[model samples]
Target: MSSSKNMSGGILACENALQRLLEGKPVLSVHVGLDVSKITASIVSLEAGFDRGYLKKSRRAHLPILAKIESVRAEAGKGSNSSSAKKVQRLEDKVLLLEKELAMVRTQRDRVLTQNLQLWERVRELELAERQNKTRQVRLHH
Candidate 1:
């Protein structure tokens, strides 16, 4: 009885995962506690109303559902691909804008540095002229 309960639980989990996948939700095989092949088999089994014997006897009946599943998966892939491309393009545009801003910042920094150097040079020249004036005054007093 315990084993049966566990089996039912696993089947229930597999069914839920399969339903999510069919609904275009992200459902990995690992999430369902089953490998890829097992998940595929479980999907067919679940679609056949948990009748494995019937599934084996009439595999054709489940083919249409399987095809539909495949198409849904393909469409999802395409949708993700397009969205990913859009994101990449947006990032590239942002990078270009950042690069331009960085260049402008660097140019401003260079200008400020040049101005600071010029101001320092002017201070040194003023100090030198003041010293010369003091020397002349001392000569006149002597």
Candidate 2:
């Protein structure tokens, strides 16, 4: 093959590799002796918070990466159930926190309402006293 043809082939291969990497698929090749390419990574197969170092560093990159991972031996039927369990736990925690805050706010509101009622009663009492004192003075003068 001519040099130009060889260069064109190389360019095509590089383009394909870049496309796979951008699509978040590993650059898997038989030459690598693995099912997945080591450079590309996908978060779907990985458990949350497993690769903190890689996550932190690659977070700034524009293209998605695919990482090669070995098939881990997992217990039977354990995968689907554990995800739901985690979601339920997180929601329960949020609900509990909200309930506690609601209760405290209700208590505070009740106290303020009670204080307002007491103030209204005090004002009524003062008005009644003033009327009675004024009537008594008028009768004494007459």
Query: Candidate 2 lDDT, tens digit per residue, 1-142?
Result: 5866754544344445544543545344422332222322333222221332333324333122322121211221345377669889999999999999999999999999999999999999999999999999999999
TM-score of 1: 0.51
Task: Report backbone clashes per prediction.
Answer: 0, 5
What's model 2's lDDT at 45? 20
Which candidate comes out best when scored by TM-score?
Answer: 1
Estimate every model's Cα lDDT from 0 to 1: 0.62, 0.51
- Residue 85, model 2: lDDT of 90
Listed per candidate, the RMSD to the true structure in angstroms reads 8.5, 13.1
Q: What lDDT tens digits, residue by residue, belong to model 1 across residues 1-142?
A: 9966765654555455457645545344433433232335445455434543322325444455555546655666667777789889999999999999999999999999999999999999999999999999999999
Candidate 2 vs. true structure, TM-score: 0.43
CA error at residue 129 for candidate 1, angstroms:
1.2
Best by lDDT: 1
Clash pairs, model 1 backbone: none
| Residue 100, candidate 2: alpha-carbon lDDT | 100
